[model samples]
Target: MNLKVAMTRSSSPANGLLFALTSAGLYGFNIVYARIASFTGASGSAIVVYRVLLMLVLVGLVAAILRSSLAMEREERGKLLLVGVSSALQGIGYLSSVAFIPVTVAAVVFYTYPIIIVLVSPFVEKTPLTQALVAIVAVATLGVCLVVGPAFSDLDWRGLALAFGASIATAVQFFAAARCTRTGVVAKVFWIQLIILPTAILVSLATGQLAPPSILALAPFAVTMTIAGYVGGFVLQFLALGRISAVAAGILYCAEPVVAAVSSALILNETLAPLQIAGGALVLAAIVANVLLEQRRRLKDAALVPIAD
Candidate 1:
């Protein structure tokens, strides 16, 4: 069966929402595993390097089986390179942040990308930025303040900074993706990972952090779970982006941090302060409100279109 047939039911919003939720959930779990990879002995840079290497191999195999070329035209290579660089940066940022803070904290900070996308979309995509959108971004920013402020004493400054940086890189990747032609989603992913793999290796080499990953007090290869999760989450992510608008997919990603919080509590025994939880709630509420308003806006715009006779 085609990968698209398995991942998407159709191009409808509901299908997109399903793909978004599933992709986010996988990513949420991957964050926990990445932290575990750290505890088990893998450095953040090492983890990203290995994950990218493995993902590129697997995605390359898939592309080969599908008879898809992994090469980009010279015209498209610039955007592909940008997307790849942003992906590498985002991966390093998120994994590195987990080394210094609780996985849940990293998640909360990184997920600010949804709001970032909305704020920047007008400039990048020519979407109108209405006053209501401004108000929503304000509310979400306040919520982010609440969420991160209460945990300031416990969170490492480096981790918080890294997580926020990841958010920016993620937004850049999404915008770049929006401009890309939609053909060969899997091929696009393979090429993107190919671009990232070398960058990861070079960074690891320069920092002298280029050790092979090993887990302590477990099966030697257990850390491969982190790499596996990275592979799966990325495959699902590109599929989701192919089927849905970036903003819609981003709004649905409100579930990711929630998934991270809950999983960290259950698996890692990490819990948030009451105030931080409330702030996270406010951020999600703002996202939910945006979802509703966007739906209404789309409906209104649809009604205005002339019906074909």
Candidate 2:
């Protein structure tokens, strides 16, 4: 029994890594689809509204079919609501960035959220500054500067700003969601989508940007977004986290930008400047280093903990 349990534990992280990679692929493809939808005249706000609504309806139906309860405690509901709002902001900012910049550049910029989270942790969680963190920050900053060097002349300033904003919002969403107790993944997603629906709707209405897409265009986009991007991607990430340490999951997530970059090049004929490619490599290295350091810290903490009697 002990050997069997050990084997299972060892295999779980491998499975988790696979799931995380799958999630990254889905998300990368979603970026491409989002760009296409936007080019077809679907505003970011409108796309978000539709995406969340479709996911909510579809996930809710799955829950109903499984006879699963969608109820949540009051605190969970509040946290999920905040997560949903942050996610909506992330979606709007990222999609807007894609409209004005190449998908690969936008993805590289957005992936800087890991570093952003570390920088803001002092204020948000009272984490102390460490030399390792400082070094990682320096490296990441250099990477970002390289990546954005051409943005000043070649890319729209608004797009650059939006990409950074999306990164920050994504960090916030991840942090907020981390605090919540585990719940049914589908149910949790359904609730988040439920909260996002009204927020997106109100934003679209208030801005008078709620230009609905043609049914022909929207039907396919909605199905793809709901099934492949939102549901499949999120579900896989959730499952992966259950089996692997978050540090390992973060490392797997680093593949997302690469996948996006390659897909954009093949599908959209987008090419990155040599400097930008180098910058992307540096950024990815910093992220990988950060995750490794975090994993080490976690192991050290675990070792220091006293075993229960």
Number of the top TM-score candidate: 1
lDDT of 2: 0.68
Q: In model 1, state the lDDT of residue 275.
A: 73
lDDT of 1: 0.71
lDDT of 1 by residue, 165-256 (tens): 99999988877765666546777887897888887888789878888544222423435666676677777777666555666666666666
Residue 105 error, candidate 1, Å: 7.0
* Clash pairs for candidate 2: none
Separately for all candidates shown, the number of backbone clashes (residues 3 or more apart, or on different chains) is 0, 0
TM-score of each: 0.78, 0.73
**Every candidate's lDDT:** 0.71, 0.68
Model 2 residue runs over 4 Å out of place are: 1-25, 94-112, 126-128, 137-149, 153-165, 206-213, 216-227, 237-255, 305-309
| 10 residues in a row with least lDDT, candidate 1 | 213-222
Q: Cα deviation in Å at residue 26, candidate 1?
A: 1.6
lDDT of 2 by residue, 241-268 (tens): 5665433454456556555565767778
Q: Report the error of model 1 at residue 176, Å.
A: 0.4
Best by lDDT: 1
